[model samples]
Target: MYSSVDTIWTLLGAVLVFFMQAGFAMVETGFTRAKNAGNIIMKNLMDFSLGSLVYWILGFGLMFGATNGGFIGTPDFFVTGDYSSSIPSAALFIFQTVFCATAATIVSGAMAERTKFISYCIYSILLSAIIYPISGHWIWGGGWLSDLGFHDFAGSTAVHMVGGVSAFIGAKILGPRIGKYTKDGKVRAIPGHSLTLGALGVFILWFAWFGFNGGSTVSATGDDVLVSMASIFVTTNLAAAAAAVTTMIITWVRYKKPDVSMTLNGALGGLVAITAGCDAVSPVGAVLIGIISGFLLVASIEFIDKVLKVDDPVGAVGVHGVCGAAGTILTGVFAIDGGLLYGGGFSFLGVQILGVIAVIAWVAVTMTIVFSIINSTIGLRVSREEELAGLDIVEHGLESSYADFMPLISSEAATTTSTNDTNDTIPVKRVNSNPNAKMTKIVVITKQSKFERLKEALDKIGITGITVTQVLGCGMQKGNTEYYRGAPLETNLLPKVKVEIVVCKIPVSTVIDTVKKALYTGNIGDGKIFVYDVENVVKIRTGEEGYDALQDEAEAPSFA
Candidate 1:
């Protein structure tokens, strides 16, 4: 019988899951360079949009239809099926559709920044319509794994692991982004552009996960069903919290401080780990799972980046694939019933291991074939020029994702200047050089924050018309060592401002004294000033030479 309450719950779950696309998009964009932000958004958007249409037309039937030899579902194209459920078939379809999109979209982060847009679209279609559904049938659609009593309540293996394994295969085939690793095999840290957006995305995913884990019950009527839903919610929250805390501590110990990005990944890793046994594990078990996931997240990311030499910008392989597999296997040990630790023996635990291994092999082989064929034919990665220039302009014709933040240039002024009479020449007057005036050029390299005060001090000492340029350098200190994503930057370069000033009438001692007064903080990084002798000076607008170029025609020198 169709139940209104159950139908409402399922629909609500679908909507929440659908919003996760935004979360994934924000996370991927923030973790990558600003140049590739638009490309990231397009990938996340199209994967869901395209995956939705294809999942409906073909994927739904293959995942939920009658079983064929307990391996694949009989093709029920267009979603015509009589799968037993209290919710309407349409409701179940939409709910499952979002899950399919989630699995397809996870690849966007691992292969971001350098992937061809068309290639990614094709990959999304294949993953949604074929790669996901076939394995989904084995776990959820009355296939061999389900018959053997493998427990994956909310798809740690079927969804997250499937996506994670595919991500690993695709990243391995695509190769690292340019400049990710040096010829000497030294790792360079390419930090994300925005941690704020990444944090927002994490919070959004955390909020939506309640629906993700709780909605799997698909019921609101009976006491047992309501209780199970509530338990799932609690376990999910506990696991994520425990994992985040654990990661913060681990990074603090290893990296000398807590890492914001890796800690966020830890929270996500906890969520993925708990997803497999949210319903079966106790709250304590959820925390234990989360803690384990935190350790795995840091270790796996380090191993993948340093040892395996894979360039995963968002740690997708670690948080999803590694933790997802660990979570599924942990479920066998933590489940209250039929668990190895619960006196049910090794049979159930063995089944869980078999399910994880089977899914990994299935996803690995299929994704390898998919990526290989794509690489050989239409090409999987973008060209060197397109990648260096960013996919936003070359691939999508977008100048920038943050175009509004850029400075506006006036085209009318540029046109007027370009069209001016260049052939006409103005009469020039050459002024005699002042032999007593020894023109001195003072170059000041100082901390960025001291620029305003330094400028004021220079003006007071009649040392105006200074040029400032932002630069990166280090003194004898060589800068303090810092950590990015747990990797130590031993030779860190600090940012400073270089101020250039040329003086003719003003005494060099006066200008130097003023600069020292303004910049001196009695600190190691107070900055230094270099004095140089200049041969001559020429003002471009008036053709004033030597001392004439350093002073206005109508004004007297402020200093002697």
Candidate 2:
């Protein structure tokens, strides 16, 4: 007899899990450059699409079929074999399918930006169809780990760690993005374009996690089931919150400010850490697990980026692989019944440790083979030209993901200039020359915030025309020393605005005095002014020269 409540709960969980694909898409896109945004979106979409189909064809059987020597499952293609469960077979299959997709999707973030689209697609198929299922059998199915009393309530190891390990291996083999490191081994910070989108994705993932952890119960009718679901929700939330807070404090002290991106990753780390033990651990245990995860997230990211020199755009390996394994092992120390701290000797903890190691070994070796094969044959990464041009343009033919907001210029107009010069000649209008009216050019290099005030001051002093350009430079200061992902960054160039003005009438002293009065802040970065003698000025529209060109048609020349 199937319970409708259990069936509904399982399906609902599957839907929530499915929505995590969007979260992954948003997070990956936001953390990368806008040029690669479309490519990231496509990869996330295809991984889930391909993962779902492949999981149904061969993955389901290999994961849930009859056991074979406690290592693998009997091949039950198309989910044809009868499986005992409280919910319908279809419901259970769909739920597990989404879980399989989650693991496969995690790799895209680690290998983002430079990966070949076809190569990534091939890798996704292999992970979803073979690598994930084989190890999944060992834990979720009646494989050796499950037989030895290994417990992973909601795939901290099976789903998250598997993805994290694959991400590490893939990123390692694929190599770092261009310009990620200097010749002297100094790490360069390639910040994500938008934290707003990353934050939105994090919130979405956090919201859907309720189904991820709670829905694992696969039941809601019985009292024990209801209680377990509530506990899972509470533990899941507490862990994420605790981890976010811990990371904020650590980054605040280390980076001298709360790092938004790292702090967000901390929340994710907490969620991944508590996932394995949400049902078995107490609320207090969840909090402790979250704190540990927070520390591990920051440390792992720093180690991987600086020492190991692996480029992970979104910190997937730290939040998923490291924290996943940590959470699973910690479960043995926190579980109410068999936890070591709860008086259940080291036996259960030993098994937990063994499980994490075995899974890591399994994913590492297999994914290495998969990536190596892909690399040796069709190639795993894009060409230098293609990468520099961005995957969206070369791979997908997309000019830009945010095309509407950009200026509209056709290819022909952008690339080619007409050779015809029929209308190039303009009629010249010579005015009376004033030999004493010397043209002077004034250039102002100042803080960007001071541009408006300086412009107003110039306008009040009868200096109407000026051009401004945003530029980067440094003087005696040589910029500030900052930390990014725990690495010291010596900023040699700072942003500033350059204002240029040419006048044949207004005295240069008058303009200089007005600028100094408006911009004097007595600060280190106040700015500098440069004055130069201009030979002449010309108005292209009217072909007017010298002082006549500098004056607007409606205004009389002050020089006259």
Question: Pick by TM-score: which candidate is best?
Answer: 2
Model 1 global lDDT (CA atoms, 0 to 1): 0.90
| lDDT string, candidate 2, 328-360, tens digits | 999999999999999999999999999999999
TM-score of each: 0.86, 0.89
lDDT of 1 at 13: 86
Range of the 10 consecutive residues with the lowest summed lDDT in candidate 2? 551-560
lDDT of 1 at 253: 96
lDDT tens digits, residue span 1-560, model 1? 89999999988888888888888898899989999999999999999999999998888888888889988888888887766478888999999999999899889999999999999999899999998999999999889999999999988999999999999999999999998888998888887889999998888888888888888877788999999998999999999999999999999999889999999999999999999999999999999999999999999999999999999999999999999999999999999998877888999999999999999999999999999999999999999999999999999999999988877678886667653655356538577467567888889998899999998988776666878899988899876677777766545467899999888778889889999999998877899999999888877667777877777766656221
